[model samples]
Target: MQLPWMSRTDRRHWKSARTTAALGELMAQWLEGSISSRPGYTPRYGPEDETRPLVPTLAALCRAGYVTTCSQPGLVGWGADDAWWEQRAAVEGVVTDPVLLHRLVDAATTAGLLVRTIDYSRNAPGEAPIPVTTRNCETAGEFGGRISEADMAAQWRGLNPDLHDEVSHGTYVIILAPEYGPTGNRLWRILAGSVQEVGHAA
Candidate 1:
């Protein structure tokens, strides 16, 4: 069946304690082909008329410890936001700290996931500096220390050159988890050491 499109305002249902519990319960049943529904609430799957393709399940992914920074109630937007990220880290054991990003990268590599690292800090400025930010660095001097002044200028945009003034200076450590065959739709990103879905940019 075609699942109804949930409006942004309607997604608040997923954040409630009761709804989260219900969804978790539903997931367990869905896996067993025993899914049921409560009054006025139902779970959705992909189009019933379409053949469901075989793909690696989330259980298998977690069994292999291949955690993405994505989490339940995962909507189109809000990837990498504090709430979604906290849920991923807390519930799914996703690695979120940039300090521990290398560990996650190593784990992904060990799990045979495709991985790439770009140390923007050590690289020359491209047409645009990677869009990463931290709340720590307060001045141009601090920003300059992490990246060249020319790259810093690249970060500036819009009518106001200081549009990004509030963002402090920091070198970005980006890890790209590009599309792989098994995970199907999942694509990951580790920006400034924090794990999130690459879909955040979408």
Candidate 2:
């Protein structure tokens, strides 16, 4: 459903509207107590410095200013697990050459991030991490004739077959944006707990 507060044009023009909407629905469900956090995990949204506890409401998320209500035009740099990386590889438009991509990942690692990527060389380390980036998805049917799912899968597998299972369903890439600052311990922690699936509500 379209958010009640959004202008018609805003809904029409937002590139990541669907993703935001989907997340909103999930957040709404959580806020209404329809879903609950699982043990050993406390879910928080919005900016890290905000002291107010998350109230499970969009207003609260908005108020805290971490879980963006609207998609920002620039990259919202974030770290994520293999699932997110896989999803990004399958669909996002930002394609990087393997060698160059590895260099960036190496830089991030040097700066202190435990990122995970597909290892391109057998002699290289087994767990090289891929840096994710934010980019648009291709228009519907744009590549229909050009690339088949099997072909895309093959290409993604080439990026790292061992990573297939983890990133197969995610939707965004993990590239570091200058605007978001360098990947480090803070970003790592955020990624680690950013999305937690709790058990069903009691």
Candidate 3:
């Protein structure tokens, strides 16, 4: 069902729009007390969406302002579990390389972020305790401009695969506007209750 809100010229790979629409359906379901809006809540995407799973929690982030409709008391950014990482990975694009990706992972360990390319090793994570900024994103872009997406998804998944089940996705999202694109895309992996919670939970 093409609701009145969806764009008429949406492309197959246009992730931001696709994600938003799918999430909106979930939000409607959430509002009607459908109550199954879990992190990997991929049960439906209406008639116009591709047959892919979507993490419904992102619906809260799709808006222009901070979300206030969550039944839970805390922000999804600081409260989601490792399972959220896997759910997100299933919906978004992924990394092209793992080893170089981890090297970049070690680079931005301070504010918890990951980049979408092996090439992302050349930049820096900016000032923020939460997932924020693109001051040092891949030279290309997260939307297939140059860099990839899975690299940024790996941060919260972390290094210990035994613990994070989806350790392949890691802990953070990637960086700023680089020379390789029409626009730089940013991915934020606001999962695992932040790095400190991860450390103390151990």
Worst 10 residues of 3 by lDDT: 66-75
lDDT by residue for model 3 over 30-110, one digit each (tens)? 434343322222323231131112223333322211111211111112113322110112112223234333433454444
Please provide, for model 2 over 1-202, each residue's C-alpha lDDT reduced to its tens digit, 9 standing for 90 to 100.
3424434543333212234333334334434444342111232223222111223323233222122211111222223532211111111111123333344346445555433342222223333332333333322111102223464354333222333322233222232222222322243323223221111111
lDDT of 2: 0.29
Best by TM-score: 1
Better of 2 and 3 by TM-score: 2
In candidate 2 the C-alpha lDDT for residue 168 amounts to 31
* Candidate no. 3 TM-score: 0.20
Model 1, range 106-181, lDDT digits (tens) per residue? 6456544444333443454433322112222211111112445554443322112231232113223222223212
Query: Can you tell me which runs of candidate 2 are displaced by over 4 Å?
Result: 15-103, 117-202
Q: Order the candidate numbers by TM-score, best to worst.
A: 1, 2, 3
The lDDT for every candidate, in the order shown, is 0.29, 0.29, 0.27
Please identify model 3 stretches exceeding 4 Å from their true place: 1-54, 64-111, 116-202
